[model samples]
Target: MRGVWYRRSAGRVQAGAVLVLAGGLLAGCATAPPRNPNNLCSIFQEKRSWYHAAMRQEAKWHIPVSVPMAMMNQESSFRANARTRRTYILWIIPWGHISTAYGYAQAKDEIWHDYQRQTGAGGSRTDYADALNFMNWYITNSRKVDGIPVTDATRQYLAYHEGWTGYRRRTYASKGWLVTVARKVGHRAQQYQQQYDACKDRLKGGWWENFWDWLF
Candidate 1:
């Protein structure tokens, strides 16, 4: 009886270990690039459209299409209606403030305020259009007054999550899960770009199809 029990326990442990390893592998696979670029733009367009329209206001700024998309990818996995645990719960309050963030872009109250002041344009923060417009303001401000040369969107994304004050490569720490999320999003951003470029000029949807067609 004892031998039988011991053998059963060992089998359970081995099975559990295998399950854990399998789970990790599956998670990695979702973020991994597909063998083909089929519907890559379709996956990205919702997020890209938001940023592309936002960036259009600043014709000279050349906000890289990859930057905002990466941020959106990281911050919310392109789910415009996504929500974090804290947003729905009063889990833990910080020293100074209570919960004040919401939306596809994860705009906190403080950050949203900065957006309003910078652009003098108003829209609901939870709305995707507003999120794009808000980021548009942030990128323009960062590039112009801050003199942050718009070289790579990934680094700019890090700074966006971290902050411009200590944006230097050495000083930056991704803060909590931002590192994990950014790594995945950053890689996906690069993947999306390559896939989009590969499908160059055969743009998926524009005037060719109405916005409603893109929805469902």
Candidate 2:
């Protein structure tokens, strides 16, 4: 009876250990990405690290947080897994989605690869930090190569959409629709700058802000 009882207790302990391990795994997986990303305050509230990520980009690349935030808002509405729509055939048939532009910045494969190579960053577009950094790098380089001021969200976004070569050739000039969208992006960036300035201190003082305080 003693031997049998000991075996039963040991089995129970093993089962409890397995349950605890599984519980830990599930908890780790349960950490969701940010919600209500369109609203800058909600974004910071949902994932405070985002504020730090933006700041990091600005400090490193001299690109404002509002610039990339506005670009992401226009590109993907800040959806991490957003994809461009596919053109339809006969206004009814389905087609493959346009470009490999995914995640917040909607960075294409070639452009994203170049960014990774240049920055030594191991993150993908789905990562807010990586996306924000990519935007800064793009904007900063645009300033250097194309003389598009980083602060001028209009020309920066035009270069972003049309590519530096296309922007130099005035390709966007012919695309009235694209020009309109770039203007909107520029306006939104200005608004975000004002909004960020108003609440940045409070945002930096949040409970989770300490995690990245040292980095900034």
Candidate 3:
């Protein structure tokens, strides 16, 4: 009888361990964002909070959602911890990166700090909410200072890469590569807008949405 009881207890312990492992795996799947985050639908599907955040930014800044999403895709490929390549001297020196730009929007140090202070967002660059908001703020400022249309991704991106003063001086014309890149960003924004339109209603409800609602 003692041997039978011992075996039953061991079986129960093993079952509990299996349950724990399965629970952990489910948690991981719940928390992990999608890979290859280039597609707008995939991105929103991976984390629905991003969709809400984009909507919030557009409403707050009067900028289109596609604009910031495309610009961020260009700047960081949507990498949460992206950084600029390090400079090298004589092809061997171990110099640090050219700028302090990092995270999704790749915002530089001073501008990022100014954004934080002005907006009181206080979120890190890795946070999509913060990055999108920063992009909207920058683009809105570009519209105001440089007269670049909010919908004009090319000039707005040019002014984004170049400062407002440099854009006013037509600095982007000197850089053909930047001009090409800006045009591509503009096109991507149009694509994202189309993709978002297709899948928006279906993406309305989920655990992430519930969590965000509870959070906010």
Q: Judged by lDDT, which candidate is best?
A: 3
TM-score of each model, paired residue for residue: 0.59, 0.79, 0.79
Provide the lDDT at 67 for model 2. Answer: 81
Candidate 3 TM-score to native: 0.79
lDDT tens digits by residue: candidate 2, 1-216: 999999999999999999999999855432344566456766776665677667766888877788888888899887778887888889999887679888889999999999889879888788778888888889989999999878899888999998999999999988999999999999988988887778887777655557547656
What 10-residue stretch in candidate 2 is worst by lDDT?
26-35
Clash counts for all predictions: 0, 0, 0
lDDT of 2 at 88: 88
lDDT of 3: 0.84
lDDT of 3 by residue, 29-145 (tens): 543545745678888877767777877677788888888888988998777778888778899997864888988899999999998888787888888888888889899899889
Model 3, position 56: C-alpha lDDT score: 69
Give per-residue CA lDDT, model 1, range 128-208, as digits (tens): 667766766676666764565454555556667666665655345646566666566567667767866775465544764
Which model is ahead, 2 or 3, in terms of lDDT?
Answer: 3
TM-score of 1: 0.59
